[model samples]
Target: MAFCTSTDINCEPCLYNSISVPGKGWCLSCEEGLCQSCVDSHKRRLATKNHKIIEKCHHVASIRHLMSQTCKNHNTILDRYCPFHDDPVCSLCILEKHTNCKGILSLDNVAKNVASSSSLFSLQQNIANLVKNLSQLNKVRTRSSKQLQSDKIVKYTSVRAMRKRLDKHLDTLEEKLLQELSSKAGTCETEINNSLSEIESKTKAAYAVQSNITLLKTMATDVQLFLAIRDIDTSVTTETNWLREFANQHNTDELNLDLNTKPMEDLLRTKSLGSVRIDRIPNHVPINHLNMKEAQIPREAMCNGIDQIQLYQKIHIQYHNEKLVEILFGCIISSNGDIILADGPSKKFTVFNEGGNHIKDIHLPGTPSDLTEISQGRIAVTYGNSKKMEIAEIKDYHYKTVISVRTVASCWGISCDNGQMAVKLLTERINLYDTNGLRIQQIKVEESCPHYINDITIAHRHIYYSYPYQNSVFCLGLDGTLIWKYESDFLQHPRGITTDGYGNVYVVGRHSKNLIVISKDGQNGRELLKCNITPWSVHFDKHYNKLLVRDSEGATVYKVAFRL
Candidate 1:
């Protein structure tokens, strides 16, 4: 649609001529413009007779931008397009470089409908989405930068405030210690001063007694002298005893203050008041970027029913030389595409890789009835005959119990999503717990009282379960409101249930020996596959779009595709 205004719009003259002429047609194969006489002569030649030449002015205008449309090696116009190599080639170029390429067509035909193709539109939309995502991320990063600046100031102020508080606390301790030292020193000084005053009074009384005794010896009779002497002796004896007791109890030892410096030394050894750690949290900004697989699907196909099931791998779960068992109660796929099966008879979990090779076997404390992965390498398991569920961590091909949740009745099936876990109990109740195994609530099922719900799964804010005796599948909201109950003859005694990205429910019928996929509305059901072995459990790995159907002895993985 673009008009030609460049200098190349004029006619390319004959190869041997020096004159230019107005173009009457464009030779796509020759990669040159043709005047009226040149157009007649071009079609007369045998080599150029079959070449595509556009005679319209608008068509020439559109193709004027297809500059330098010639093979570099052959110096020939690139007229043919090799579909296999995805390149335009001349006759000589195709013979040399793309001889084996198939579906080679004329370049003009190949590019005629490109502008109206869905691929072009999709590419444009992808570019737009990319720009929008970049803008969002840029805004988030800019805001985060500003937040970092503000947080830096706030953190600095907080640190300074803590230092000041520490200084004040130390000052208080120092003041209390100094005050105690001063009080003790003052008491010592007062005691010494009181002792000095008492000594001085005693000395003065002794001098008075000596003067009286001297006067009596010179001028008084024997009776007066004797009475005075006896009174002085009594006073002297009491003073001597008091002085002896004081000397025994007290000594002039040095009043040195010894401070216990251990606490101060420990304080000085501290490196910092506290640590400042930077933790990388999940990004709050949603970057809606589609990967290759998601981007290739047409928008309308996203909500369509599953088109077909392609078998990916078939795995025989029995351990080497082990006798056949009848109780493989639970099956799940780890994040690494490793299949983990809970063998009730063996009281252990068996692991196998995507290639159907046996990896390892992990022993469980109790018989596991159902298991679900709560996070990467972590699973919550419900025991069939026990009143507790064990949370275990899978590491280095081994598993260890992390925690346990106690139930009022025996635990059966378990499913976990987001941070919440829904565990099916032997009674008609589902015990809800957090990831840490703390029971938060109990959802009582009034529909299946005598026969409890067999398997349970939670997805997309909805709780799904199977009632084997009732021969039905029930979907309920998180608050236990019934959404739909699916009853079908094909789903006889459904034991295990799971969901896919399209919200389609996949369940296994133990008695029917089939795997059936129900619609999201629970109004329709289709048996995806039937097996010779009775299917005990079913699990769908949404990450890889693979289906896992398991029995006591074997399991199969299928790659699922959806169609509009």
Candidate 2:
């Protein structure tokens, strides 16, 4: 270029001057043009360290107004100090109330601390982003609200149209029925009025010939005969024709209309239109099926010191010094595996777990012959000597009797099935009662022996009772029908009996000290176990794998484990 004037400030030589570099401002205090790097070094000097150093705006004219402006509240001229507080506040005036505040600090100092903290910048950025997101969310909410309002209007319109159609159909049906009834009533009324007018005319003519004596007598006689004939004809012809016509028109199967007969009002009032409604049959499709395989019993015995038996396996055994005591009554186990001794000479019932832990002792008013778990966590106990049965719910190892009944004979055994309790009285009769303690029925043993009923076990809609003297077990249905009687040949003195879920009957004989397993259908019988002691009060647990047996002489309970 034609040799730029070196004297011009805007000349290439001036622009290339090292001191006139970019990103710089005129330093008025230093009276020199300084770049940002040069000013930074000058600010770090010990004397200028506390001085204010702001970024230089590339356009000085744009920020020039801010440099001289004063804070309006302080009414002070712009200065290089905070006009609101202590230090050289410049021409700006600080309010008296704010002058004493201790929070005053230089703006540059505050900015420097904030800039040095990365967390402060991150927080500021996050706040700004959140504000932007909130604006966008507000627009989305407005759009969704508009759409919802439009959808509601559409649905309301459709509902209104459907309602109108339904109302129209109902109105048409109502109008048609009303018209038919009105027409029928009008026709009947017109016919009745015409018949009444004809009868009135005949009566008026008969009254006209009552003046001349002899002529009136003949007229009267002839009129009477004519009236009688007319009456008979009216009864047989007119009334009958009117009834037949009315019946045919109305489709009435029966019609009877007579003035002396009962009024139509009475008939209408007495008539009742009944309807038979058939219940809707439900679909028998099952939503889910449970494939429960029959539990298999292990061949080897699994005894936990206590005998472990599977379903129908004798779970409890009691030995009294190696002699099997006569266990003729029932037995029950608590939720904690404690056994309640029943019918033993303990005269008092004792509770013990399978681990031989004695839990409680229940003193009896009389000899408690039988025990069974009823509802509400209670057991039904029958006192043989007292001839009374009581149901008690157990809570906190205490008894709360809900019902009590005195037996006609010594209560020997008690059993519950299908919410009904059956008590075998010593009189060889089983009395049945509802769960409410109301006697429903009674079953009397009619066998030739008529032995005393010692124990009763209910299972699968049948009651099995033992006849101790007869050495037989009788099976009876819910209605007391004798289903079958099993007479034991080898077993003598069958004391107690229980049933398994598979309908297998188990009988324990004290004399033989054996458990007899009989098929449900009375097809086969086998000796399940032959212990030395009498197996009394046999019961199956929820698992049906183990049996609980109580020995009267042993005064102990045994858990016998047997396989299915």
Candidate 3:
């Protein structure tokens, strides 16, 4: 839980393990190993590019030995050593201690052959084993602590709940006993839960040992590993002892409710004739935890800023006196900042340069309802009435279709993240598709939205869909669990939704006629800009901090700039 610096974690892989290649430098803020490949990527991100990185030299590995020079006992020079006890001693200890021990030697002599020692590998394995054990124990203790808090809250709530029930059951003896039973058992539960707090002290010790050993294994060379192994083992052993003490002291007590008859000697007492007395039986059972959260999530490889983006750029397909009723239903900006759009009335997909200049317009087979940037400059567009979709690309200023497929039903709204795409159909169901354009799964929009699923977008590995009538946006995980829905202050008729590279979502509110920026976690929302007319679409250029918004009344695109 303690944040370690870049020197603690191994530099990120430069394609392969950095251990095999020399580190170009270290990103101190990210605590990541760096290579030339990520240099531009890191500098592009709004949150991370400003991070300070130190370029490392070839001799950096040699300096790993410096990690072992500190003496734990004296915080001084570790010069003397005792072979019998296998412990390092400082100069103050050479005169005052280890004088009577036989076969005493210098600290360096004991460590000279450590890299070649048979125990080096064994010690490394031991350290790894301890890491696994301590990590699991730490997680279990942490969960237990949270569960304990929940149970405490439940107990407090039950007391008030039982008090009300007692009033209702005043005439019934059985109900009176039930209320007394809960009250007595709640007290016993608190004591047992309070006692479990002792595990925290031990878990922290194990965590410290695991961190130190893991850091040594990663940042230290083989010889450094050998020299630090004994001291690390001592610290690990102390943590192990703490864990043992926790196991010995911690217990899960079971509450028992029994009927206790009131004494006949107290005839004037108004209390219930029979009462429930609670007792606890301490059970020495410990909890074992399991099930990993998930494998991992990959993020955007590069970051970009939008300082160069200009305003008042528009893309309109007008053939003198032709009425283009529904123009831009949805739009997307590719990772390279090229713009893509679903031109509904024109029945085509439009591509624009990062500067908003019209490039190539690839006419679709039918009315293109919604568009999502698939990858790079490639895009997937859905047909409103054709019940079909196709993957297209804009390369070298030319429009080319990659593939076309007919779906079971017409899907209007589409979005893609990672390799997955979600298509929002007219029936208010989202069809999930893999990279091959094959429908993998379908998710239903069950939230209370009086309107249609206007636009679907994916970000942070989750799906975000807008409903103008609901005046809100709902965020759901890829598995279809609704994480949170925002319908608060800044939102009016939130329509199109898209996430920036940093996980912040930008949405257009048709009713409020403003651009809303909701945080990635869905905890807050703020109106970033107010449009003169209701904005039909809001899309973020993945390569830059620029946001592209098109008003409903015109073909004009508003290029706005803001920090993540």
Candidate 4:
């Protein structure tokens, strides 16, 4: 080990390099020269108390490079390299984020000859390219701003011209319509109040019974089951009868929104002067890509024609408790590397540890389609052709549904962000709903693949959807406007889609029998891997870069070592 710049000749500096006078000791674990004061302070902190330390020697063999950098998240030394992300991380980060990432490199090997590597030269060239592109974009944005001001004036002039041309009889029509609107609003309020009261009472009773019955089952005792059996039977029977009655009597969806001059309603509203719908102006603004850096793998590997996950481990989860069944559609990995898979044939969610050892399995009410993590031990799962989405909480290897909401039709892929959910309906539209199951917006695709959406993923303002039947993928804005559409020869039956932190999209192609990576702009694509088994569902942990893929053929889930 080489001496650090912090090491002094007269008196060993403190653990922190800034101290002028020192003379206490050295932390062998931290590999830094420490003073008596720092040594005392170090032991006082809970995280560093047990670290190895020794008296300072003439030649302090402390870490010179490692101490210079730290993990941004944990605020500790960056000592580990996450090969999946191609970034240095701390030990704390390894468990918090990279537990599912299989192959991790040490920082020591990554730093050796890094200065001479072409990566540094490429980075310099990128910076130069970014500067040039950004300068041009700034000019374009300035021009657009000026054009916007001019357009505003022109639009205002047109509005005034049209208003002057309108007839004076409009006031009588407006007054009559306002009265009818107010009357309708009053009636709607009363209907909403009645529904709310009934819903609240029934929801409370059903939840109470569900909790009691689930608790009874968990207790696994004859006495508890016997005690709750009568109440459980009564509650279940009452709720079943109430559901049938409510379905017949409910006036929930009778009213329809319209944009016609009169009461004439058209589901597809187009070519109207006043259209109330969600849309976006085409994004023609040029963005500087080089400065907006994405996660970078060893471009050398990519350039050298190494286009695969490199090392992948598969866990064939066919049989559970001596019964074999095929998995449904999805897979998710917890922060601790616990694999939870939804099996359609068994109607169960099976779990396994990082080492592929069987854990506990949770039963589902129906066939599961897709699942997304809600919290550390909770997830939201969708049931295919059932039109039901259930939120489940996992505790001690047991799972129970806490909430369930019905979508408009058969729900397929489900992803949630900002407490709002984007659910793909069987009718080839994505419905945005609030936490309380209120539909906020419906995303209808008119450009392409207007048939069926296999999977959808959300990241901030961007929504990604895969068109399996059409062999295409589309990136859209939150307002449901297409940002860009990608159709590739490499993509055949794109079943699952996910995005990395770099805005790059990854899609699994069932027909192509490969995992494909599409650039952030949807302009370029390359095969990530040629699969042994056809892949259906795919998910990427952006924080960890670990890829979880489900094979459509069987109960096998492949944990691929995904790199940037």
- Name model 2 segments beyond 4 Å from true: 1-329, 343-346, 448-453, 555-564
Worst window of 10 by summed lDDT in candidate 4: 286-295
Answer with 1 or 2, whichever has the higher TM-score: 1
Which portions of model 4 show Cα errors greater than 4 Å?
Answer: 1-109, 112-328, 447-453, 553-564
The TM-scores, one per candidate, come to 0.56, 0.43, 0.43, 0.49
lDDT of 4 by residue, 1-564 (tens): 011334452224432455576555656455566767777888898999997555543333322222235455877866677755645778999998889976687665554433332343344343333334333433433443454445444544543454354455344444444444445444544554565455555555544444443433333222223222322343344444454455345323232222223222321242223321111233233322222122233344333332434535455554332232222377777756787777776788788875667888788788888888766777788897888898888888777888888877788888767677787777757888765566799998664343554688887678888887768898889889889988988789888788665566778898898988777777778887788777777776654445677665433444334343
Question: Model 3 off-target regions past 4 Å?
Answer: 1-328, 395-400, 448-453, 553-564
Cα lDDT, all candidates = 0.64, 0.50, 0.60, 0.59
Q: How many clashes does the backbone of model 2 have? A: 30
lDDT of 1 by residue, 1-564 (tens): 112334344467664487677787877556578888889989999988997676653344432433345466887766776544435678998778888765577766544433332323343343344344434444443444454445545655554454455555455444444455445445544544555455455545544444444443443323223222333444444544454454344422222333332233454455333334332233444333222222122334445554433233445554421442444387888888899877776778888898888888898787788999999988899887778898889888777989977788888888988788998888878888999999888887877754444788988888899888978999988888899999998778888899986688988888888888888888778888887877777888877677788775677776665322
Best by lDDT: 1
- Which clashing pairs does model 4 show? 328-344
Candidate 1, run of 10 with poorest lDDT: 289-298
Ranking by lDDT: 1, 3, 4, 2
